[model samples]
Every structure is written in C-alpha cells, then in structure tokens.
Target: MKVALIDYGSGNLRSAAKAIQRAADENALTLDLKVTARVEDVVAADAIVLPGVGAFADCYRGLSSLDGMIAALNDQVITKAKPFLGICVGMQLMASVGREHGEHPGLGWIDGAVELLTPSDPALKIPHMGWNQLNLLQPQHPVLAGIAPGAHAYFVHSYHMVPRDRAVVLAEADYGGPVLAAIGRDNMVGTQFHPEKSQATGLRLLANFLRWRP
Candidate 1:
C-alpha cells in the first residue's frame, strides 16, 4: 500500500515517518511510504497521514501554501474515501474553524472548532503535555483495535477540538477536565495525541491503521 506522509513544513516528518515505517515492518506489511509535499503524490497514495505541530493558524497556512494540496486532499480523502490519519494540529485542521491566533478556516471535514484548553481547574497547565490515559468512547473503532480504554498516549497541545456532533469523538483524556483525544467519521480519523511518540501504544495504533481497510 502507498501511504503519503504529508510534509507541509509544519509537522515532525522524520519521526512520524520512522514510527509508521516501524509499524509496517513489525506487522510484515509491505507499504510504500512517501514523505511528500507534492499534490500528485497525495493523489496517487492509497492512504494519507498528515502530521502537524505548532499553532493552528500557522499549520493551516503552511498546508494552504502548498499549491493544490487542499483540493487534492479533499478529493482523495473525502470524495474518494481514502483512509486518512491526522496527528495533533493536523487533527485540529479538520475542524471548521480554529481560534488559536485568530479565526482561521479549516478543512471543515468534521463539524467543530478548535479552541484553547480551559480546564476547569486553575492549576492545570495550558499546554497539556506528557502521557495521558485515553478514555475510549468508541472502542470498537477499527483504528483503535487492541488499544484498551485506559491506554496512555503522548500529548502536547494548548488547544482542543470541540466537535458539534459528539458522535465524531472517538476518545478523550482528562487534563483537569475532558479533552478530546481522538475523532473520526467514515474513512478519516485524527488524534490530538502524538501517536509517533506514544511508544508501544502508538505503534499498535499505527499498525492497526496500516491494516485498516476503511
């Protein structure tokens, strides 16, 4: 299978690619992984993985700067129903709008908005870092197969996505309060946590994603 690891200059390209490659190797799955910025590569790929870090507006800007990338992504991932995985800010980009710097439009694949993490407790940090236990909302989801409800995943972010439709949320973590950990609909799934940095749990999820037919 051909997997396009999108490189729009905002994500941890090498680490994400390495983790995905490791997953494929461990599963004995033959995957043609391509770390690319080209729209043609994305169009030709069997699946797509979008990994991103930093601010929402900045990441969106970087991705939009790439000629025809947005359109191609829409066609391949949405129109054609290609399997897609978005990590961290890449997941936030799936929301309708982002309120990090200013109100910036997103891909709007999922009905939601990205907003700052305002934990109910005052002592909690803005950027929710480190490993947190995932509370699986949809444990039966294919990408989450073999991943237990309390499995720990690494996270580093100051904002969280609030999906208007609660059914899209697949998992959540508590950082003084409930914070979105995962979201999905149809062939698309996203994680606020960095699966590439989540060690064994991360690898398991990635391996599941690699074999996921949807």
Candidate 2:
C-alpha cells in the first residue's frame, strides 16, 4: 500500500517516517511511502498522514500558504472519504476552532474545538508528556483493534481535544482529565499521541489502520 506523510514543513517529519517504516517491517509488509509537500501526492495517496508538531495557528497559516494544499486535502480527505490520519497539531487543526491563537478557525472537518486541559487539581502539568494509558473508546475500529484497553502512548502537548460528537472519539487518555485522545470520523482518524514514539502499541495502531479496507 502507498501512504503519503504530509510535509507541511512541520516538525517530526523524520520520526513519523521512521515509525511508518517500523510498523511496516513489524508486519512484514512493504509500504510505498515518501514525504513530500506536493498536493498531488496527497490527492493520489491511498492514505494521507498529517504529522505535525507546532503551534496550531502557525501550522494553519503555513499550510494555507501552500498552493492548493488545503483544497486538495479537503477534496481527498473530507469530500472523497479517503483514509486520513492526523498527529498532534495535525489533529488540532481538524477542530472547528483553537483557543491557542485567539480563536482561529480550523479545517472544521470534525465537530470539535481545541482547548487547554484545565485541571481542578493543583500540580497538573501542561503538555502531558511521556507514556500515558489510553482508554480505547471504539475498539472495533481497525486503527484501534488488537490494542488492549489502557495501553500506554506518548504525548507532548498542552492542549486537548474536545470533540462535539462523542461517537467520533476512538480513545481517550487521562493527563489531568479525560481528554479526547483519538478521533475517527468516517474515513478520517487522528491521534494526539505520537504513535511513532509509543513503541509497539503505537505501531499496532498504525498497522491496523493501514490494513483497514474501509
């Protein structure tokens, strides 16, 4: 299968690439994959991965500047229902608006908003990093299947997702609160955690997504 990792000049590109390679190797399957900023690659790709690591507003601005990138992405992902994956800031961009930048509009592909996870408990650290357990809300999804409930995944962001549709959440993790850890809407799926950094569990999730026929 061919997969395209979006290179929006976003951070974590190489790590995401290595992770995909690792996942494929673990499954003994070869994936035709490359990192390109080209819109045609995204349009023609069997699966599109939007790997991001940066501020939501800045990422949005950069992507918007790229000629026809957002339009092509919308055509392939939002309209055509091609399998799509977003990581970290990429996931944040899928929200309707993000408070991080004074209420900037997102792709609005999913009904949600991005906000800081405020904790009633004191001493709750922002950017909940390291390995944390995820409660798989939608276990039947190919992207989440075989991954046992309460598996640990890597995360490093101050903001958390609040999807308008609870059904869109595939998994949730506790950092200081129960935040939407992952989302799957129609042919689109996104992860706040770095599957690349989560080791075996993360690889399983990525591989499961790749093998998914729908």
Candidate 3:
C-alpha cells in the first residue's frame, strides 16, 4: 500500500517518516511510504498524511503554493475516499478558519474553527507542551485501535480545533478544561498532538492508522 506523507515545506518530516517505517515493520506490513511534495505522488497514494508546524496561515500558504496540491487532495481524499490524517497545525488546517496571527482560511473539511487555547486557570500555560493523557471519546474508532484511554500523547500547540460537532471528537485532553486531542469522521482523521513523538502510544496509533480501512 502506498501512503503519502505530504511535505509542504514544514513539519518534522523525518521523524514522522521514521515512525511510520517502524510501525509498518512492527505490524509486518509492507508499505510504500513516500514523503513527497509532488502532487502526482499524493494523487496516486492510497492514504495521505498532512503534518504541519508553525502558524496556520503560513502552513496553508505553503500547501496552496504547491501547484495542483489542493486540487489533488480534494480529489483523492474528498471524492475518491482515501483515508486522510492531519497532525498538529495540519489538523488545524481542517477547520473552517484559524484565528491565529489574524484570520486565516483553512481547508474547511471539518466544521470548526481553530482558536487559541484559553485554559481556565492562568497557570495552565499556552502552548500546552509535553505529554498529556488522551480522554477517549470514540474508543471503537479504527485509527485509535490498540490505543487505550488515558494514553499520554506529546503535544506542542497553542491553537486547537473547536469542532462544531462534539461527535467528531475522538479524544480529548484536559489542561484546564477539555482540549480536542483528536477528531475523525468518515475516512478523515486528525490529531492535535504529534503521534510520532508520543513514544509507545504514538507508535500504536501510527500502526493503527496504517491498518485502518477508513
């Protein structure tokens, strides 16, 4: 199976690639995982993973600058129904708009807005860095298979996707309140945290993602 780990001039591509490789090896599944910026590569991929770091507007611009990328993604993921995963700022891009560094348009795949985290307690912090436990909302979801409730995942972001529909939230984490840790619907799935950097929990999620049918 071919999995396209999209390189849109951002994200820690090497780490994600390595984690995917490790997951494939552990699962004994032979996968053609290619990290590419080429639109053609994404068009032919069985699954697509979009990982991003930095501001939402910048990442969106980086993706939009790539000729035919947005169109290819729409065709392959929205129309063709190939599985899609977005990580961190990548996940934020699925929202209708991101309110970071001025208002920025997003892919609008999910009905939500990316807003800055406003933890109730002032001492909770902004970025919400380090490991946090996932409060599983959709325990039966395929992308979350083998990932038990309360699994700690590494997170490094200030903005979070405030999904319009609560059902879309696959898991949540509490800082000062419930933070959207993951969301999924149909063939699309996303995580606010870096599953690649979450150690065993991350590895399990990656493995599940590879084996996921939808």
Candidate 4:
C-alpha cells in the first residue's frame, strides 16, 4: 500500500513517519510510505496521513501555500474516498473553519469549526497536554477496532474540533467536559491526540488504520 504522509512544513514528520513505519513493520504489511510535499505523491497514494502542529491559521496557510496540494487532497481523499488520517492540528483542518488567532477556512471534509478549548472548570489549563482517557463513541469503527474505551492517548493542544453533526464524533475525552478525541465519516478519520506519542494504544490505532479497508 502507498501511504502519503503529507509534509506541508508542519507536524513532527520524523516521529509520525517512524511510528507509521514501525506499525507497518510490526504488522508485516508492505507499504510504500512517503513523507512528501509533492502533489503527485498524494495523488498516487493508496492512503493519506496528514500530520500537523502549531496554530490553525498557520497550518492552513502552509498547506494552502503548496501549489495544488489542497486540490489534490480533495481529489484523492475526498472524491476518491481513499482512507485518510489527520493528526492534531491536521484533524482540526478538516473542519469548515478555525477560530484560533483568526477565522480561517479549512478543508471542510467534516462539518465543524475549530475553536479554543473552553473547559467548564476555570482551573484547567488551556493546552490540555499529557495522557487522557478516550471514551469511544464509535468503537465498532475499523480504525478503532482494538482500541478500548478509556485507553489513554497523548494530547497537546489548546484548540478542539466541534463538529456540527455529533454523529461524526467517534471518540471523546473529558477535560472538565467532552473534548473531541476522534472524528470520522465514510473513508475519513482524524485524531486530536498524537497517536505516535501514545505508545501501545497509539501503535494499535495506527495498525488498525493501516489494515482498515474502509
């Protein structure tokens, strides 16, 4: 399988790549994994993985700056219905718009908006960092196959995706309130937590994603 780990000048590319490669190796799955900024690579890939870090506006800007990247992604992942996984801010980019720093347009793959984390408790931190338990909403989803409810995933972000349609949310984490941990519809899925940093649970999710046919 060909997996395009998109490089649009954001995300921990090396770590995400290493983790993905490790998952493929462990599963004995043959994969041509490419960490690429090239549009052609994304066009030819069997699956797409978008990993991003930093601010929403900046990440969107970086991705949009790449000539034909957005359109290619829309074609390959959206139109073609190829499997897609977006990490952290990459997941946030799936929303219709983002409100971090300023309002910016997103890929609109999912019906939602990216906004600052507003935990009900006044004492909780802005960047909800560290390990948090996942409350599986769609545990039957292929990408979440072996991942149990209450499984811990690593997170580090001040923003969260608020999907307009609640059914799109696959998993959630409680941080004074419900925070979106995962979202999906049809062939697309995204994780707000960094699966690469979640150790065993992370690897399992990645492997499930690799083996996922949907």
Candidate 5:
C-alpha cells in the first residue's frame, strides 16, 4: 500500500516518516510511503496522513496554498472514502473552523472547532507539553486496536479540537480537565498527540494505523 505523509512546510517530517516506515517493516507490509506536497500523489495514495506542526491558520494556508490540493484531498479522502489520519495541527485542521490566529477556516471534515486549551487549574501549563495518559472513549476503533487506556502519548500544543458531536471523540486526556486526545469517524482518524514521539505507545498506534482498513 502507498501512504502519503503530507509535507506542507509545517514541521519536521522525518520522525513521522521513520515511525510509519518502522511500523510497516514490523508488520511485514510492503508499503510505499512518501513525504509529498503534490496533489496528484495524494490522489494516488491508498492511505493519507496529514501531519502538522505550528499554528492552525499557518498549516491550513500551507496545505491550501498548492492549487487544487485541498480539492484533491477532499476528492480522494471524502469522495473516495480512503482512510486518513491527521496528526496534531493536521487533526486540528479537520475541524470546521479554528480560533487560532483570528478564526481561520479548516477542512471541516469533522464537525468541530479548534480552540485554545483552557486548563481550569491555574498552575497547569498552556502548551500542555510532555506525556499524558489517554482515556479511550471508542475502544472498538480500528486505529486504536492495540492501544490501551491510560496509554501515555507526547503532546505539545496549546490548542485542542472540540467536536460538535461527542461521538466523534475517540479518546481524551486530562489537563486541568478532559482534553481531546483523539477523534475519529468512519475512515477518518486524528490524534492531538504525536504518535511518532510517544515511543511504545506511539509505535503501537502507528502500527495499528498501518494495518487499519477503515
């Protein structure tokens, strides 16, 4: 199978590429993975991975900057019904809109908004960095097959997605309160944390993503 790891000048693509490659190797699957920005490449891929870093508006602009990229993504992912995984800001971009940088539009694949993570506790950090435990809300999700509850994942963001439909939330983590960790519906799945940096837990999720049919 072919997987397109989108490169929109958002952040480092090496770690995500290496992790997914490792997952494919461990699974003994002959996978062709590429870090690409081309719409044609995205259209031809079996699975699509949209990885992002930095601000939501910036990432959205970068992804949409390429002519026909967003439309192609919609055609391939939404129309074709291909499996898709969005990481971090990429996941945030799936929301209908984002509050970061003065309310920017998003892919709207998922019915939600990306808003700043507001920890009720006065002492909690803004970025919500470091390791945090995941509480699985959708245990039967294919992308979360081997992932266990309370699994620690690396997170480094100040904003989190708040989906309009609660059923789309796959998992959540506690910051000052419940924070979104993962969301999914049909063939679409997203993670607020970086699976590439989460070591064992991350790798397990990556492996599951590689093997996931939907």
Candidate 6:
C-alpha cells in the first residue's frame, strides 16, 4: 500500500516513516512511503497519514497554505470512507477548535476540541512524556487487534483532544485523569501520542493500523 505522509512543516515525517517501515517489515508488508506536500498526493494515496507537532495555530496556518487539503479530505477521503490516520497534534488539527491560538479553528473534520493539558494531579507533571499504558475502551475493532487493554506506548504532548462524541473515543490513558488517547470514527483514526516514537509497542500499533480494513 502507498502510505502518504503529509509533510507540511508541522510533523516529524522522517521519524514517523522510519517507524512505519519497521512495522511493515515486522508484518511482512510492503508499504511504499512518501512525504508529500503536494495536492495530488492526498488524492492518489491509498491511505493518508497526518503527523504533527508544535502549536495548533502554526500547524493550522501551515496546513491551510496547502490549499484544498481540508476540503479534499473532508469531502472525499473521510466522507467517502478512505482510510486516514493522524498523530499527536495531527489529531488535534482534526478537531473543530483548539485553545492553542485562543480559539483557533481546526480542520473541523471531527467534532471535538483541543485544550492544553492541565495537571489535575499535583504531582503528575505536564507534557506527559515517556511510556504510559493505554487503557483500551473497546478492543473489539480490527484497528486494535492484538493490543491489550493496558499496552504501554510513549507520549510527549501537553494538549489532549476531547472528542464531542463519546462513540468516537477508542482508547484513553490516565494522565491528570482519563484523557482521550485514541480516537477512531469509521475510516478516520487518530492518536494523541506519537506511535512512531513508542518502539515495539508503537510498531505493533502501526502494523495494526496498516492491517485495518474497515
């Protein structure tokens, strides 16, 4: 499968692609990878991957500069059930609004909001870095196959997405509390953490994503 990694100045495409390549190798699957900043890549890709880091406002501005990415994705890929995945701030960009820019609008593909990760726990630390266990809410889906309820993965972010619909949240993790860590709605998949940086567990996660067919 040809996996188009959207490289539009907001994400770590090299690291993400490296991890995905490892996952493909592990699963004996061949993934033709491309870091694309072009319009045709989104349309011709077998699946789309949106990976990002940094502020929501900056990311949004960078993405908007691409022209018609949001529209093509929302109107064609997502609405038409084409496979798509998002990582870290990439997931946040899919939300309707983010507080990063003091009410910055997002891609509005998913009904959700992104807010700074405030420490409800006095001792827990911000950013939520390092390895943490994922609390799987529903493991029945193929996208989560072989992934246990308490699988560990690396996380490095200070913001989390609060999906407006409970049905869209596939998994969560205990940070300040139980924050949304993963979301999936039909063909659209999102992760608030960097699966690419999570090592073996991360590889498995990406492999599962590659194997997902719904």
**For each candidate, what TM-score against the reference?**
0.99, 0.97, 0.99, 0.99, 0.98, 0.95
Cα RMSDs, all models: 0.6, 1.0, 0.7, 0.7, 0.8, 1.3
Off by over 4 Å in 5: none
Clashing pairs in 1: none
Any runs in candidate 3 off by more than 4 Å, and if so which? none
Which segments of candidate 2 are over 4 A away from where they belong? none
Candidate 1 weakest lDDT stretch, 10 residues = 118-127
Candidate 3 lDDT over residue span 1-214, tens digit each: 8999999987889999999999999989889999999998998899999999999999999999999999999899899999999999988898999999899999989998999999999999888999999999999999898888899999999999998999899999999999999999899999999989999998998888888887
lDDT of each: 0.95, 0.87, 0.93, 0.95, 0.92, 0.85
- Candidate 1 lDDT: 0.95
lDDT of 3: 0.93
Candidate 5: 10-residue stretch with minimal lDDT: 205-214
Alpha-carbon deviation at 124 in model 6, angstroms: 2.2
If candidate 3 were superposed on the true structure by all CA atoms, what would the RMSD be? 0.7
Tens-place lDDT digits, model 4, residues 1-214: 9999999999999999999999999999998999999999998899999999999999999999999999999998888999999999999999999999888999998988998999999999989999999999999999999897899999999999999999999999999899999999999999999999999889999999999888
lDDT for residue 143 in candidate 5, whole number 0-100: 86
Of 1 and 6, the candidate ahead on TM-score is 1
lDDT string, candidate 5, 2-21, tens digits:
99999999956999999999
State how far residue 214 of model 1 sits from its true place (Å): 1.4
Q: What is the clash count for each candidate, in the order shown?
A: 0, 0, 0, 0, 0, 0
Instruction: Score candidate 1 by TM-score against the native.
Output: 0.99
Please list all clashing residue pairs in model 3, or write none if there are none: none
TM-score of 5: 0.98
